[model samples]
Target: MTHQQILDKLSSKYLVKSIDEDVARLTYYAMCFEKDHNSQFEYIFPKLMLRWNCVLNADKNTVTDHYRLITILALCIHLHKYGFADKDLTAEALKAIDKLNEAVVLSDDFFRKSEEIKKIISSLPVPLKRKPSIPENITFYREKDVVSIQLGNRFYAAYIHRLTGVNESPVIEFYNGVFDKVPTIQELEKLNAKGRVYNDGTERISHFSVSGMKFLPDLANQIKLISACVEQKPPHQHLEKSVGLYIVMDIFKLQDEIKSIFKT
Candidate 1:
């Protein structure tokens, strides 16, 4: 799944739950922000300028891991307010601007000050580091070329290619959504043995921590089954998005926005 697609999948309220739900929503929103980073310049500027450098470091164990870091940097590098849901500070600030701008005439400094104040308020406690250069896959047959792989476009692969400085067109064939042998729900249920923290407003995960395969037929199961089926085969043998990397991207996006509120 391309970064956007990964985020889009995880954004479903159905996939997230528990303490992780907030994190997941944050990730989804941040992925959107990365797509159109400058659209809300007033909101994102503070993150880019102030906060991102601290948590992110260039070093990673794998191209997949490295790609994830960059995505997080892109997503959370800038936060606009305390949070993005419901009543975010940025929304309030935007409102403040609407009120101020409605006055018809004002000094350019006033507008400048608004921007300045936002920058200050949204500044990250520490600067985010630039993502490290992508390490070349030294292993033989690692398939350095993402295009050659049948897997569609998980964000990790694409982001890794970008980080490693690989300039290839996005791999879209994976999204056609086909598999050599689609597993039955019975088979899928067997594979749905693992669980992760979800920040879900909607009930998604049927299994709890260390719990047996809780039987909830939500998208989470389908997604995981697809992921497992794909993972069971060679990375080349499966579809791209089934990698399940998007779940992490979903959370990263939200954290970046939250960083904004903590700025000043």
Candidate 2:
């Protein structure tokens, strides 16, 4: 999950909008722990410490310490929700939580002093036993590969293309034409030449990273690459430096927009 998705989920779930970067990052790690609990603390703790140290090293201030305490509180809350027992929590984790409780008692911040953070923590949803349904046998596709999605009785085609950058990622570009059956690569190529392509709201080609999708399991399964074609060099595009964390596309939301466009 991307950091923005984690922040949005945390905000909506807790009905609180005051989450800072530290809280979001710690919550993300907590979720990662829940997903890979069998990995043991030896593996997870070092990574957590590394992440924590990086943030602290980047900015050393009293405000950073305050955020760190809040993050620790949020992590402990999530860990308990995931059914971690006292024995399961490490000494450091226990100590951090104790520190958070002590800080909360003396803190003057409106959210902390009023115990709103505690209320929000207590209101977290019941934990799930499994992560989001990503197919066990996953297939990674490269540029020029054709994929399909079935919406009702009609099928839509898309082709994969890599963006030009240091951190290039595969993006799926959807065609505008609807098909009675999955179209062949040759047919999609012809359609592409005729300018039969879907453009997103920004007037850019309708594209997204498939790995970022979290919901719409049926659509996810149907969108696997169907055919591989010749690799064409991707066009050059300017990339912007992301300010905070990466934003993940919600494919379920994208599916809704597509359905509305086709009135399906």
**lDDT digits (tens) for residues 1-264 of candidate 2:** 322332343323321222222223333445566555545333334433333332233234422554544444444444444333223333444454456556663234432333443343444334445443332222245567666765545677766665223224345656656887667766665554112123332233345554322211221134445577746322213222222232233333345455654556
Question: What is the number of backbone collisions in each predicted candidate, taken in the order shown?
Answer: 39, 0
* Global Cα lDDT for candidate 1: 0.27
Query: Candidate 1: which stretches are off by over 4 Å?
Result: 1-21, 24-222, 226-264
Tell me the spans in candidate 2 whose CA falls farther than 4 Å from its real position.
Answer: 1-139, 163-169, 193-204, 212-221, 231-248, 260-263
TM-score of each: 0.18, 0.35
Worst 10 residues of 2 by lDDT: 212-221
lDDT against the true structure, per candidate, is 0.27, 0.42
lDDT of 1 by residue, 140-247 (tens): 111122211111111111101111113211111112122333333334323222122234422221210111111123211111222311322112222122333222
